[model samples]
Target: MNKTKNNFIYNIITKDLKKCKHKKIYTRFPPEPNGYLHIGHAKSILLNFNIAKKFNGICNLRLDDTNPSKENKKYVNSIKYDIKWLGFKFYYDIYYTSQYFYLLYKFSIKLIKNGLAYIDELNKHQISKYKGNFNNLGKNSPYRKRSINENLIFFKKMKNGFFNNGKISLRAKINMLSPNILMRDPILYRIKFNKHYKTKYIWCIYPMYDFAHCLSDYIEKITHSLCTLEFQDNKILYDWFLNNLKIFNKPKQYEFSRLNIEYNVISKRKLSILIKKKIITGWDDPRIVTLSGLRNRGYTSNSILNFCNSIGVTRQNSLIKISFLENFIRKELNIKSQRLIAVLNPIKIIIENFNKIKEKILIPNHPQNKNMGKRKYVFSKEIYIDNKDFKEKKTNGYRGLTIGNKVKLRYSYIIKAKKIKKDKNGNIIYILCKYYKNRKKNNVNGIIHWISKLYSIPAIFFLYYNLFKISNPENKKNFIKYINKKSLVINRGFIEKNIKNINNFSYQFERKGYFCLNKNFKNNNIFYFNRIVKLKNII
Candidate 1:
């Protein structure tokens, strides 16, 4: 491990290991494959994967794909793809909790035989009422004293698809009056008649997440079962199941707070509803931060992994600003991505007197990186300036060229718009300008980005904004009520001819935004460039 700038959790784990306390560290990311993975999942992935790597240990890609009601093969595959994309290489085989269904069932039966577990015949509401408080403890189940043979017979029928969903659950026979309510005979298995993707209809009963989680860890010999803070309350029962099962090398669960992002809700249910209602395009909607979504919006995997490392691991909850992520992406791209020009909202600006150049002018792709090299672009007498860059009325910080004002065309000549053309709708259609053609002294506030009018590349520029109106609305409330209706405002514009030669997957539209190739790109390319944040505080 490159022990460089000491990251927080690494230091702790390093110190702990130096003491010669624990053997080779083993970590696992056990996600329930219910929905698409998000940035929060990225944090967990980095934490677990990094821990294993830093200690020369191992990490397991274990899917808690037990509940067939919500799980699917598609989600399972996506989870695998995402983990690989984030640069994690796992050791041993990928394990699923369903793989342990037979062993888990046998263990449950053994518990029943030992008077350590029993079949709770109570309905959902009755079970909830009896599952009591942290300090007050729980009321005992009426059927807690059923004989092992009788419980076994009912449970066998349960496995044979005899019981309806929620009709019966195999529960651990822990303390009813225990202060820790999770251990108050928690449900170990439940009847879900739905066919599992992996197991099919071989077993009707599915193991609970808590039951399957620790058992799978022990079975895999995971030294550390890393989890989020929400699972801390369930640790009492986590320990109970391991002790009851008498599994060797029981994995100890350590809880850390899951990541929360501003203006973005991380709940899978909320994201699903948003997609269903057409609130956003889909899970990867650029506005939402799913892995595919981030990739679509041009976030590098390296930046995401670095962002996770920058955040580090901690038990304390963190509310990371979306800026933190944006910074890293920009940082990575600054060295990697070339600078090109594409004006999103366009107004035609003409040079009244200038060299009638319609051919390509070679410009360095990225100024800092010579290895990225140079490409040719069209510089013409007539071109497009952002409509917003020009105004009939002027404001205080307005540095752009309005009518009769002089400004530099980037890497070219300074020009002044002498006249303007307007359509029937009173929209400014074109600008007539005079260019200064000296071997020149620098002039104009800035060379506000300009695109060639000739050798046109049909690129669609995007002024992407947040999807949510409220940064953080109240929980489970009508978040959709605050959806930003104009999150995406598209503009058809032209870029320099050099950009026409750019490999479509990634490109920068200089002062305008960052763009990538659309999967459905054609010769008459429809370029989709998301505003990679704003050009330094335009908002």
Candidate 2:
């Protein structure tokens, strides 16, 4: 509503409204509640909800809980939490596909009475053989010729739990030779004895996804039933059900390509395996892009919405570089987060001339925003600097600490390294330095941040890399083989003591990157922070 964007779907809705095709715009986000919502799902949510907002209409949150075996209450609650966290609200009370089970049963009965559907005696494999592939013409089932009354009796038996799972299925009487495979006598109902979380054992024969989807939209009066491109072929069947049922005010569906990100697989099945095998921590592991994962990793809702908008809605399938998302997250956090110092690989620096007294240093929490105010950190004789900031021997044009090298202690003093202390092994244990307060005279090379060794608090830092080594891990025969063993590397680090008082906001660790606390921690007084994203200019 702020400013119209150039998206084909939005343009279509605008045309529809102008032509009075719809008195008001209405859309719905239909998730199955089988798993956590991923970044791909986020795209759909934004598209539907934003389209409704743009036209001054409404959007509904509908749970398509057709297969109760995979669905559960936890998934339902998590889906709701993710939607609200993304800054969108449902227009009405939450609706479930289970709510229309009885209505769906009646429609199927009408199909049977109209001779448009029948109960198939063919087994699962036999049906597949009859419903031929692209190269072959399909043959109708032997039972396809059964009378409507007989089919109705069998279907009633199916509902009464007389048939075991996969014993019988109800199929629409579409063309057996239809070139479009989905329209070739697709199944309308299947026997599943699994107890539904919502409906319980009230019904054993549940309607198939294709049959329930269109009818649910029709029942709720959704004007636009947006879906992904994989369902384009199924659109034929989506319409067939509505038309055959003789329903009024039918909903129209439009297909757009689902979002794909490189180096990550968004499939729920693969993600479930990753969780079941304990490969990654959980669904909210920061390495993956599930909405809860992004939230736990400190990604802002506005950043995700902006990323979806920047990608633009289109029908052509494409793979977006993961950096496209990281760039937006970094851009948002740069303005919203305050700057703080943290040393991952610490090495001690002793100011030889400075006395062992702690002095307060005041620095702005945000560089450009004065309203964020300043925080006071104590600086003492001894401080911890990043191990990478120094070398026992200087490299060509190196600006960091080495023998006789002078560098500014960021926002503090220009100091020259005098000597280094080593243990039995040839590793530096500490560095000796002398401060030159007369900064005008000394040619300081560069500035590096540090934390007071005395006043700093110890915290665990999680440096996460890509979970999979291959860009398309899901395509591999064995995806677990491509899992990166070093995906999560833990390091004990130090942060400014005042960080303990910081709330649920992102903080930049100077030269390192932006980081935030892993909200899942439960240990007593032991804190852990996850690296949200490294500092890089992607734009």
Best prediction by lDDT: 2
Candidate 1: regions farther than 4 A off: 1-23, 132-138, 176-179, 354-360, 370-373, 439-446, 473-478, 520-525, 532-535
Candidate 2: RMSD over Cα atoms?
Answer: 2.4
State the weakest 10-residue window (summed lDDT) of model 2.
1-10
TM-score of each: 0.91, 0.93
lDDT by candidate, in order shown? 0.78, 0.88
Give the CA lDDT, 0 to 100, for residue 382 in model 2. 92
Query: Which residue pairs show backbone clashes in model 1?
Result: 340-510, 504-517
lDDT of 2: 0.88
